[model samples]
Target: MKKTAYITGGSKGIGLGIAEALLKEGVSVAITARTQNDLVETEKHLKTIGDAEVLIIKSDVRNLADEEKAIQQVVDKWGGLDFCIANAGVGRFSPIDEMSAEDWNSVIDINLTGVFNTVKAAIPALKKSKGYIFTISSLAGTNFFENGAAYNASKFGVVGFSQAIMLDLRPYDIKVTTIMPGSVATYFNGHTPTDADAWKIQPEDIGQMVVDLIRMNPRTLPSKVEVRPSVPPSARK
Candidate 1:
């Protein structure tokens, strides 16, 4: 049977790349974003890639109800979900003293709580299918920097949460993995990707990794993975 996957924040960046990869592998994918226009455009783009079914859901990960509804829609259309990627996230960079309460809350709500909501909503279906869960974290989840208070906290929470859930879900044969990637070339944090980004890890690289993980033998589980570009700009002469 063909597998079905759902990705949060799937309109662009890493989410879009994962959707494309899965579609190529004949896995029906449902992508969710907060904007209907972006979702519609993504659906059109994904359709051109392969014949696999693509569903675009307009949802905000911060809302548990929205996530629950999105999961139901995918289940209704695809019968069962084999994979769920909690890739929805945001970055708010500022020193604690300089950060606004609103900015801090927005980062935590979307990056950390959002993962909780997505996984919570998808748990039942995944348990039934003995499926997989992928949570996107970052190197910053472990390494802190100046002006990264809010972003660091949220990502750190994600790492911890993902690990704990991995253990919790394992009893049901649900696989959970946390992918921590460094410096991907994506339109994240208001930065535009350019030719200069050629040295960085591409979003599709992460997508391909997901494909490989899913294809691995059921007896082996790589619970945590950290990915980095073989060479960074700083290493260049």
Candidate 2:
């Protein structure tokens, strides 16, 4: 049977990398985000990777209704869902005193509550198929820093929320994992990957990691994975 996967924030960067890798392996994957242009571009790129097994969905993780609809569409088209990846996230880096209410809420809404909505929306189909879930958290989730208060809080919540859900869903034979990546070269925070960023982890590395996790033995569950660049820019210099 052909397995199906749903991914949030799948238009670019790590999400797109994962989608491309899965599609290449013949996984019917659906990716959702709010940007129409990015979705169009990603879908086109993915088509070159495989057949027309990729679906582009315009959705915002902050809205439960949107997530529910996106999941339903994939399930309807694919017969079932075997994987759900909560990778949509945003970062607002400002000191506690300088951040506004909107800044805090935006980060929390997309990075924290967003994961809640993604997994919650997929549970029914996931329960039926004994699916696997991957939460794209950050190393900042565990380590704290100045000028990163909002981002840190949201990622920390992601780490905690996913850990708790792993327990909740384990009884149903559903596997949950949180991926805390360190310094990946991607388009996060409006920055593009370039030659200068070569020392950081590549999005494709994380993509391959997801495939490896899903391919692991059914009896084994690696619920948390932390991936970092083998060498930092400073060390490489």
Indicate which candidate wins on TM-score: 1
What does candidate 1's lDDT look like per residue over 70-176, in tens digits? Answer: 99999999899999999999998988899999999999999999999999999999999999999999998998899999999999999999999999999999999
| lDDT (Cα, tens digit) per residue for candidate 2, span 160-214 | 9999999999999999999999998899999988998988888898999999998
- TM-scores for every predicted model: 0.99, 0.97
- For each of the candidates, the C-alpha root-mean-square deviation to the true structure, in angstroms, is 0.8, 1.1
lDDT of the candidates, in the order given = 0.95, 0.92
Candidate 1, residue 68: CA error in Å? 0.3
lDDT score, candidate 2, position 167: 98
**Pairs that collide, model 2:** none
Relative to the true structure, candidate 1 reaches a TM of: 0.99
